[model samples]
Target: MATPVLPRSVQRLIDEFARLPGIGPKSASRLTFYLLRATDNQALDLSVALQELKERTRLCSVCFNITEDDPCPICEDEARDAHLVCVVEEPLDVLAIERSRAYGGRYHVLHGAISPVEGIGPEDLRVTELVQRVAQGQFTEIILATNPTLEGESTALYLQRRLAEYGVRMTRLARGLPVGGDLEYTDEITLGRALEGRQEV
Candidate 1:
């Protein structure tokens, strides 16, 4: 049988949804149809929320994490240990670390790991900004909290070499995190232990 045609607008939304990570064509179609059936106010509410998400948020100038301000709230908070910086791969990783409540330091979000296969390299991320931050002589410790993947390890080693000249305390998150695991999925207990047991690089 020939494929049935969907409304142009509906099909457009479905295509957009299908492009998102982990969302397949079937799930995208389901979401599009669900939105089609939703009350006008409900659908409009979601539309407005999505618009505002892009309109109101930008990367933090300091850490490069998504934020509504130049510096994110975490960067501005005086209570956090400014001398200690936990370097993570993304904003999601920052949330993961915060959930553990075991770290009271500032964060530097690299936004992504160095994946040569994916065409992502040090220049593609916020590495230069991190080097500049360390050169400022404000932070005393640099914690390499990037995920435990091969790419993550590669990125961490690259950072270690790049930042070695600053004469700062550099440490890596301990071995409790699985070798192939992403930090975003690690449980609080395990993540907390890893934070506590971090060792010098």
Candidate 2:
């Protein structure tokens, strides 16, 4: 069999693209070719934007959400209800809830849910930080907005037990969402109704 004749730079770009989720070798090649045909300024702008994303972004210390500053805008905003905290599996999930505009509480990003098969346990997540936050007794309500998947349910149950000592009211999102669907994909209207109709877990 003859060896492929791709240039080193082209091969490298293909490999990098393949590493991204949902991008296969064929799509990667298409993207690389598209970028090659794009104006130099377009590629340069994309490169600069990617560089600045990592360089300028930081995790908010309070909510653990991605932000340019230590405390995220939601955490810093006085108008938000500090007495309630919404717990989600990822930073994107926080954005999802925010888009609904029904939740006025602060948020805690767990980063990941409890995936036993994937070796992701409670210790692997931001559970300790949540415990500390609950101990502070600042929040009276904690809404477990983790997805409606098995791992998400397990995480919420675990948190419910762990946080019981804090005396803060605990609730979970209404289960009208399709099981195993990512919260990030749910529309704002559905998510808003889910939040509003949340029940004690």
What does candidate 1's lDDT look like per residue over 1-201, in tens digits?
A: 978687778889999999999999999999999988999999999999999998999999998889998789999999999899999999999999999899999999999999999999999999999999999999999999998789999999999999999899999877678889999999987898889888889
lDDT of 2 by residue, 9-118 (tens): 98899899989999999999999988999999998999999999999999888889999987878899999999999999999999889888899989999999999899
Cα lDDT over the full model 2: 0.91
**CA lDDT for candidate 1:** 0.93
List runs of model 1 lying over 4 Å from the truth.
1-4, 177-201
- Cα RMSD, each candidate: 5.8, 5.9
Winning candidate number (lDDT): 1
Q: What is the lDDT for 173 in model 1?
A: 76
Model 2 stretches with alpha carbons more than 4 Å out: 1-3, 177-201
Measured against the true structure, the TM-scores of the candidates, in listed sequence, are 0.86, 0.86
State how far residue 71 of model 1 sits from its true place (Å): 1.5
Choose the strongest candidate by TM-score: 2
